[model samples]
Target chain A: MGHGGGGALSGELTRHLFTPAYGNETLGGLGDSAVLPLPGARLAFSTDSFVVRPLFFPGGSIGDLAVNGTVNDLAMSGARAAYLSCAFILEEGVGLPVVGRIADAIGAAAAAAGVVIATGDTKVVEAGHGDGVYVNTSGIGLVPDGVDIRPQRAVPGDVVIVSGPIGLHGIAIMSVREGLEFGVEVESDTAPLGSLVEAMLAVTRDVHVLRDPTRGGLGTALNEIAAASGTGVALVERHVPVPEAVAGACGFLGLDPLYVANEGRLVAFVPRTEADAVLAAMRAHPLGTGAAVIGECVAEHPGMVVSRTGLGGTRVIDLPLGEQLPRIC
Target chain B: MGHGGGGALSGELTRHLFTPAYGNETLGGLGDSAVLPLPGARLAFSTDSFVVRPLFFPGGSIGDLAVNGTVNDLAMSGARAAYLSCAFILEEGVGLPVVGRIADAIGAAAAAAGVVIATGDTKVVEAGHGDGVYVNTSGIGLVPDGVDIRPQRAVPGDVVIVSGPIGLHGIAIMSVREGLEFGVEVESDTAPLGSLVEAMLAVTRDVHVLRDPTRGGLGTALNEIAAASGTGVALVERHVPVPEAVAGACGFLGLDPLYVANEGRLVAFVPRTEADAVLAAMRAHPLGTGAAVIGECVAEHPGMVVSRTGLGGTRVIDLPLGEQLPRIC
Candidate 1:
C-alpha cells in the first residue's frame, strides 16, 4: 500500500516517524495549524528542504538535522526563531519505528531551540517513487530592530569570523553511507544556533553577513558572499577550525574539508573594529566555543575567494559547478 | 537527479507538463518565489498539496488543477490572492514536455488570477519512485478589513450557497483514470476564484463561512463547517447544482457526486436574511455566474450534515473515513 493511504501504513509513518521527531505542544494536538503568540519584533521567514541520504547517520538522524538546519538558517538572518511548519514526503515501506524516532528527534530539537511546530503536512509516495523521506520546513522568527544582515552586505576590509569547527556533518554522513568506521566517533555538527546567533546579535549590530557552511561548505559560502557583494575574501588556513576526526576522514576520502558541510557552525562578516567583540560573544556560547577570526575581505579580485594555505601557497576557492555528493542536503 | 534540482530535467518538466495548463507571468519565470503587490489589505495565507494520479485528465491537467486548487483555497479564506509558491516532485523518466506544459498552465492560471509566482522548488525521483508529478503550492492573499469569516463562525439560520455546479473535477479525473468518459465532455472545473471572492467581499461583510468542495466534495466540506461551528446543516439536493454530464458520469461509475471533488466552485455560508444579496453578488462574478442557494444551517443535529433528497428522503453526509481515490489531492 502507498504510504499516503489513510490506513495502517500511513498511521505507522505518522505515529512513529513524523510525530516523534517533530512532536511539540501544538503538534501533539495535530491540528491544521500551530497557533503561536506573536512576539514584539519584525519577522524573518525562511524555508528549506532536506533530502540527506542514509536517514540515520553518526551523531544525528534526519529528524534532528531537519530542525537544526532550518533553525540555523533563520539564525543567520539574525532572527529569534519562533515557529516552524513541517511538510513531509515519505516512501512506502519505510519502517514506522524509524519514522517515529525521526519524529522524536525533531520534537527534541524544536524543544531545545524553544520554538513550536505550528503547521504540518504529510504525503506518501510509491515505494520506488521517493527516497526514504524528505522533510521540508518553513520557519519564521522575530528580527530585532537594528540587526540588518545579508550576504550582499559583506564589504571590503570587513573581518570574517567562523563559529567553531566545520566539515563534521558532511564527513559523518559520508562515513555512514559508505559504511566506513573511524576509531573515534565523528557525529554530525547538527545543533540549533539560535542562542549563539542571539548572543552575537546582542553584542553588536554591525554584523554584515551571516551564513551556515552547508551544502557547499565554507569555501562555497565565501565564494557566494564575495560574488554577491562584488568583493574578494582571503582566509587564513591556521585560523579556520576543523575537528581532527573530520579532517582525517576528509583526507582519507580525498575530500577537501573546506568543501565539506557543517550544520552547527556559521560564518559572519563584521566591521574590522567590532570583530573582536563579536568573536568574544560567540566564544561564550557552548556551540561557538572555538570561534575565531578566520578571514578578511579584500577589494582586489572582486567576486573571488582565495585561501592562504598552511605551506605558503594561495588557492582560489570556487563554487562547485555540479552536485558533489547527491542527496547530502 | 531529484526534481528540485533546478536543472535541465526540471526545466523540461516545467516546459511540457506545467506550461500549457497553468501558465502565468510570475510562474513563467520559474523563480525562487512569486512576488506580488499587496492589494490594499492584510494578507491571508493557505497552502495545499496535490498528489492526484493520471496527471493528465479530461477537462484539465494537474498543472492548471494545482494552480486553481490552491488559488481557490486562498479565496475561500476571503483573500485577494497576491502570490504563490510552487514545489514539484517528478518521477524520473516522466516526459519532460509534459512537465513543461504543467508549468506553463500554472503560469497561465496565475496570470488569469492576477497573481504572481514568487518562488518554486523541484525534485526528481527514480522511475516508479513517484507517480508522475506531485505539486505543492502555497499562496498568500490580501484580505480587506471587516471580512472576518471562518468555518467555526457559521450559525443556525445561515443560508448555504454554492458557486456553480459540483463534481466536475472529480469526474474529469475519474473519467481519465478509469477510461470511461461520457459522450459529452466533462471538463474539470478548475479555475482561480480570487475575483469571485473579491466580488462577494465587496458586497457584504456578513459572509460567515467559505469553503471549496475539493477532495471529499460538497458533503465533506459542509460536514466540516457544521462540526467546526457546532451547528447542523440541511442541504437540499434539488437546490444543489450538478452538471448533467457529471451527474451521468457519476451514475455510470457508481460514484456519489456528493463525495466527489470540485476545482473552481465554492460554498459560502451567509445570514439567511442576506442570502439573496450574497447570491446576487456571487452571480455577478464571472466564475460564480451559476451560483445558487444550496441549503441552510439548522439547530437540530448539531455537528451533523444532512441532505434532503429530491424524493424527500434524507441521509447523513460525513467525512470519508479512508481514501476514496488515492492521490486525488
Candidate 2:
C-alpha cells in the first residue's frame, strides 16, 4: 500500500497528481529522469519541495501548486523553464482518486506553462511514517543573453514592484487547515508567472531582483534581499496591494498579511529610470493585472526593511526566525 | 525536531551512525555539502536517497550507507567524485545525538573517499508523519574523455566483474529491522569505490557496464543492464565471492544475497581480452581487494540474466517484482 510500490496506489497517485500538473509530449511518459534537449542559452536550474497539508484546498491542490511553484521560481530568475523533475512522497492509505486528481492538475499546469515533466520518482511510506504526500520538483531553464538579474544588483533608488496581491495562498491554506470556511470564498493565488516575467524582462533588463513571496511572504523576502544586497528597503503600506477577502481572513486569524505566502505573485526591483516601463509591461500580463510599485531601495539603514503605515507611522519588517506556517509549501 | 533541522538531534545522529564506519578528513568536518576540486575533467553528476529504517544494523547505518552509496553511484560512471549535496528529512522528536552521529559518519565517508561536502538542506516533520530520517545525496564527479562507460555499451562476450562482496547492506538492514542479529559481525560493505573505479579506468577505456547493486541487489542491476544493452547476462554463482557471514545471514533470513543491497561494491562488464588487466587494477585498490569475476554478457536470451548455481544448474534471475526489503538503501 506504500506509494513506492508501483502498484495501484503508486499508479493512482501518478495518474492523478503528477501527470496532470507536468504532462508533456516529450517527457516520455515520465521516466526516472527527463532527457532534455539543451538549448544554446546558458542554463539556470532550481529545485523546491512542497509539503503543504490539506492536499485539496481552495483554488488549488498540491499538484498544480507544485508545478506553478517551480515554474515561477524559474521565472523569477528570468529564465525560460524547459523541463522539470518531479519526485513524490506518498503516505499509505491516501485515496487513489485524490492522487489522480493531483496528477491531472500537474499535467494541466505543465501544459498551461508550456513546460514538460521529463523525469520523476515516486516513494511511498507507511501510514504513520509519512504525511499525505510531499512533492519535490527540480527545473532547468534557459537564461537569455543580455539579461542579468540578481539580488546583489539592487541599487539605491531602485523601484520595487509586486506582480499581484499577496497573502492569498497562505490564508487559503490556513483556512483549509483550520477548517474555517468563509461565506465568501477566499481562493489561493496559485498560478504560473513565466509570461508576466517574460513581459517585464522584454521591457527592461534592468530588473535587479525578482522573488516570490512564499514561506515568510513579502516581508521576509524583501528583508532577505536587503540583507543579501546590503541595502535598505522602504515600502508604503498603502501602496502594497492586498485583496479585501485576504485581509479579512488574516485579521480574523491574527496574522500579518505581509507575512503570509503568495504563490502566483512576485516582487521585483527595477532601476528607477525603467520603473514605469516595467510596471506597464507587468500590467499588460494577465497574471500581473494588479501589479503596482510598492517601494524603493534605500542607501540608509543597510540590510533593513521598513514600511510606512497608513497613519504616518513606520515599522521595521524583519526576517522570520521561524516558520509561520510549517508545511504550507 | 525534524531530522533535517540542522539542529542538535540531526547532529547527534550523524556522529553515531556515520562517523565510525566511514570517517575521513574532508567528511569529518561535515559542512552543508561536500566541496571537491574538479581538476580539469567534465563532471558526471548523480543523486540517490536513503530511507532505510532501524538506523543501525549488521551492514551499516543510513549515514555512512548513504554517503558511500552516492559516491559509488558516481564512480560507476568512471568519474572522480568531487562534491556531494546532503539533504535530510527528519521526523520530529528524534534524538539530537542520533542526528549528529549521522552527520559525523557522512564526514568520515567523504574523507575516506577524498570528496567534500559543499551544501546541504534540513527539514523537520511532525511526529508520526515521517520515519526517523531520510537522506538524499547528490554528487558531482569529473569524468575524463574517451571514457564512455554506460549500461548500453555491454557487448556480447563482455566479462562481468564484481569488485568485492555483495548484498551486505541489504541483509544488514533487514537483520536489524527484523531483530534477527547474527552471532558474528555481519557488517554492511559500505565504502566509497571511487579509487577502485579510477584504477579500472586507468587500465582501459573498454569498460562497458559499471553499476553498484543497491536496491533490488545485483540481480536487478544486471537485469537493467541486459535490458538497456539488448543483451543477456550469465552469472557463475560459485565464482561470486560472498562472505561467510553474509551467506549465513541470508540463509537464516531465507533471503538471497544476490538480491540484497551493497553500498561499497560495483559490477563492471568489460571485453574479455582486457578483463585480466582490469581485474588486476581492481585488486590493487583497497576497496576492491576482494574483487572477482562473477558473470559475463552474451548475445542469446536478449534482456535476460541467467546464473549457474553451485550444482551447475542454470537458473534465470528475474527482476524483482516488488521491493524485497523496502527502505534498504
Q: TM-scores for chain B, in order? A: 0.85, 0.85
lDDT of 2 by residue, A1-329 (tens): 12222223333434453333222332212221222222233544555566678888889988878788878877877887766555566676666566556766777788788876643444556678888777666555667677766666678999999998899898889988988876677788899988888998889876888888777789877876886688999999899998888888888888888888888999999999999999988888988889999999999989899999999999998766566666666
Candidate 2 Cα outliers beyond 4 Å, as residue runs: A1-45, A95-101, A114-118, A142-148, B1-47, B56-60, B77-85, B95-97, B104-121, B139-148
lDDT of 1 at A274: 88
lDDT of each residue in A1-329, candidate 1, tens digit only: 22222223323443454344322332232211122222233445555556677888888888887788778877877876665555667676676566566766777788888876544445555567677777766665666678777777888989999998889888888888888887787888899999998888888877898888777688877877886688899999878888889778887888888878888889999999888888899898999899989999999889899889999999888776533454565
lDDT of 2 by residue, B17-96 (tens): 33332233333423212222222334455555666777776546787876787787777777777655555677777765
How does model 1 fare in lDDT? 0.71
Individual DockQ of the candidates?
Answer: 0.08, 0.07
Query: Which number leads on DockQ?
Result: 1
Q: Which stretches of candidate 1 lie over 4 Å from their true place?
A: A1-43, A93-99, B1-43, B56-63, B90-101, B120-128
In candidate 2, position B77 carries an lDDT of: 72
In order, candidate lDDTs are 0.71, 0.72
TM match of model 1 to true structure? 0.82
Worst lDDT 10-window in candidate 2 chain B: B1-10
